[model samples]
Target chain A: LGLGLTASPLRAAGLEPNSFEDITSYNNYYEFGTGKDDPARYADQLTTDPWTIKIDGLVEKPGDYALSDLVPQMTIEERIYRFRCVEAWSMVVPWNGFELADLLELVGVKSGAKYVAFETVLRPEEMPGTRFPVLDWPYREGLRLDEARHPLTLLATGIYGKPMPNQNGAPIRLVVPWKYGFKYAKSISRITLTDQEPPTSWNMANAREYGFYSNVNPEVAHPRWSQATERRIGGGLFAKREPTLMFNGYDEVASLYQGMDLRKNF
Target chain B: MIDVVNRSVRAIPNWVLYVAGAVPVIWLYVLGFQNALGADPVDAIERNLGLWALWLLIAGLCITPLQRLTPLRLIKLRRPIGVVAFFYVLVHFLTWLVLDVQIPSQIVADIIKRPYVTVGMAALLLLLPLAVTSNNWSIRKMGARWRTVHKLVYPAVLLAGLHMVMQAKGFQLEPLVYLAAIAFLVAMRWMPLSSFRQAFVKR
Candidate 1:
């Protein structure tokens, strides 16, 4: 409790850089825009100031909370972890954010809020990809209430000692390091608590590839590819591929899914 | 140009051969920037290798048309260049099939179930016949049929290009250039002015 803002457990883990110039340069974020770096480029146009999240559906306090009023209510902390994608790739990122649980708690998730659906702002003038029907507009992502409340789950707002880059899902993005990258939605505008499981973008498009609970386990391969091993990027020509860890190197997190069958869930 | 270069002179100096041999090796060294070899090392390792394999394939596809037009006599260089192209692609597919997937049967299942993978495997299957027949013996035995046998390279090139496009979630311009070049080369095949016949007569 006596720890300084810079000396907290969150600071220690978050100190490590999650988003880098190189990583940001080679990103695949589609919310702010289509190109990998478009989020970083076009995301600055987003006015995080005076921003209000529309918390609706089954929430007891179903109303708008300004970015200022809401952010201070939630704990801002950092967590260091490897982010693995179902596409058989991974990244070791140190996130600068807080737990999703705290936000849900503050909003007072209703007893009937079994599922949580998140939405990103959709403006074709700024985000050209939104103009195209790439997926359902506003870029929707959903999580089961339990999954949303998982300790590993994060509500990231910034990276690398800076406000979130437009490319890196600036302002606010979810950091669920265990799931595939797409599961960690970016540029969030709305958070709706629902009685039934909400339809997610990826699962709706290809249910076989993405499941509601997309925890990173090697045994449960995507219908298109296995998740057994992954390459350590920038490892030279002679360097060998590394075996992919279950829960994307999060044994602490993997314990949460102990009773569940990943294969069936996948 | 072909007469001077392609002719096998037993007493010829070995340095020329070494220079030719070192092309791919030297190029790879240059590409491996500060020991970072593949694409976006910060990203997943598999993505880097996958991009590298596609780059090699693109380069290989470029060789055919470039040689036909260039005065540098690149014809003698085609087979070796192609073999290297195949090497990178082999590594690319192998990285996915072995390290990523880990089981051959799963890979087989994936190809069957996924249209993207099925298209890629089809391109690889088509490449097998070209690789097998890439010998002087096959060229001599097949004779005029050799042209018929090699014509498969056209579709092989096309499928390889499509494999890149299919795997991509969005439009990228680089793959389009490779596809365009391959299309241009295929168009040349239908020309009344054959590049092979034109190469023999110089201005």
Candidate 2:
């Protein structure tokens, strides 16, 4: 809670920042509920204090690291990022955190590690929605080692110059700006470095609809809806949908999947 | 008891049912304009209108069933309810066309490619004739044919129910409930328990 935060100059592709109201009110935190505003109403039950992240599997230094201990180890920087949801909605958010690479380095990734798997906190009592099988419990996500180590990958601890709201992944969350919003798992409690490609919750739930890579590709449309364009959050009902950019406007990330077919991977 | 209720229902003119049928759509529009329909207002409005259309269509289906089971003369309300449901379906289609799929080309492709959209459009198209011939004048002109033409509503309702079930994101209970309700209503029309009892008593 006492982590010092310094604002970074990293701006998100010239996109205007969404309002604080828009950021907090409209969310897809399934742990709290499926509805956009459900988290804001129900996430108060989640206990964020005295939290710990269990880093194990393919790590040289594997142990439970308390949040207080981890925050002090690295300088927290505010990075404004353009978050694109798989549902064709976009938001520019100011996130306060350090790089996932830094956190992985702190844990000391072992030589055999090929992927980094992330797991959200699974306290059914605190999270009322877990009782229903909206998704496989303890929502899981994974990144290829290179993607995890990339400079753009961040472990966001807060947003809008404030610690994250309970509904908005309070203690810690992954923010891979290049991938869809669901790829960035929220309320992350355990991160396991593994050799095999880990199973992501959405991908496991519906492989055709949600792919493992889940890169922001305008070409690959979800089975139910088109993803060629996205409506910017806070934009009124009549606002025209802006053309969606491949890799969410971070074209540099294309090198991450240079040879592989995105459509097949997707 | 039936006579008393029918007397009260008659006292209230048919115009009241028309206004009552319109209230939900008006409420949806107000919520949408006020930005009170949560984050995705377009989806909310579209879904609400479609659901209401399905509901009114179902309600129209129930008219004969209610008459069969009870002394209620809800036959006069059927045309008004069907007409209201047609308007709701019209608005639902418009919301999808104007809001969701702004590109005219894409809308055509969607109607052709997407099974749910095709089914929904078919349902709407099927209801058009019924709505047009709902007047007493057309009823007199068509006579025996009018009743046969209106039978299309059952298939339209079935397609509408299927459209809802297919459109849902996950295994939702709401769409399933709508389908079950329609199924029950249709089954009641075909095999009313009272009719079975009458047959048994006659034997």
Error of 2 at A207 (Å): 1.4
Which is the leading candidate under lDDT? 2
Which one is best on DockQ? 2
In angstroms, the error of model 2 at B147 is 2.5
The CAPRI classification for model 2 reads as acceptable
Considering only N, C-alpha and C atoms within 3 Å, which residue pairs clash in candidate 1? A39-A166, A39-A167, A40-A166, A40-A167, A234-B41
lDDT of 1 at B29: 45
Candidate 1 lDDT over B16-118, as tens digits, reads 6446645654454456545444334323334554455556555555665555555444555556555655655565577566545555666777888777788
TM-scores of chain A across the candidates, in order, are 0.86, 0.95
Candidate 2 lDDT over B55-173, as tens digits, reads: 78998998887786566897877888899999999999998898777877778877887788999999999999999998999989999999999889888998999999887653455
Isolated chain B TM-score per model:
0.68, 0.90
**Alpha carbon lDDT of residue B109, candidate 1?**
78
User: What lDDT score belongs to each candidate, Candidate 1 first?
Assistant: 0.68, 0.86
